[model samples]
Target: MQHLDDSTRTELEAAAFRRLLHHLDEHKEVQNIELMILADFCRNCLSKWLVAAAEERGETLDYETAREYVYGMPYSEWKSLYQAEATPEQQAAFEARQAAKQEKGQ
Candidate 1:
């Protein structure tokens, strides 16, 4: 990686990102709250990041469009098909995770 050219490095990173999206799409049962509790990011975070990246590059990307790209469909469709209500235990765990992050000044 250290020896890779800039374009090659960027290509590899983009490929990895696509792979991540595919993996997440394949695992639709994984709830966003679970992701936030464990990794501090979810599909929505990815969509926001995508929009920010496009803006940084002087490109236009709205949140809904980014979400469609990430979710393989409109977010509303995906939510209605696969999203589930978080259990009380999940909510508690997410709250604890947030508290821990705040305590660590993250």
Candidate 2:
């Protein structure tokens, strides 16, 4: 951290992001709702953030396009191939977590 220049840090961060995308592609069984319930973010959140980052730089990036990048395919295709329905427990936990976050004003 101390010695790295800005360009080096940026390159490393991009590499890490690519690694994360690769990991997610490899683990299609890990559903997005589970990610939201456990970590408060999911693949769609990454797509939204990607679109926001593009907007911040005065570029236009649509959610579906960004989702294609994140999911390694068209969103519908990815969903058909890998997405699973959330179980009752996952839904309940997600609701509870959202309520807690709302109470905390997060």
Give the winner by TM-score. 1
Backbone Cα, N, C clashes tallied per candidate? 0, 0
Clashes of 2: 0
Off by over 4 Å in 1: none
**How high is each candidate's TM-score?**
0.97, 0.96
| C-alpha RMSD for every candidate | 0.7, 0.8
Question: Candidate 2, after superposition: displacement of residue 28 in Å?
Answer: 0.3
lDDT of 2 by residue, 1-106 (tens): 7699999998998999999999999999999999998999999999999999999999999999999999999999999989888899999999999999999999
User: Considering only N, C-alpha and C atoms within 3 Å, which residue pairs clash in candidate 1?
Assistant: none
The Cα RMSD in angstroms, rounded to one decimal, for candidate 1 relative to the true structure is: 0.7
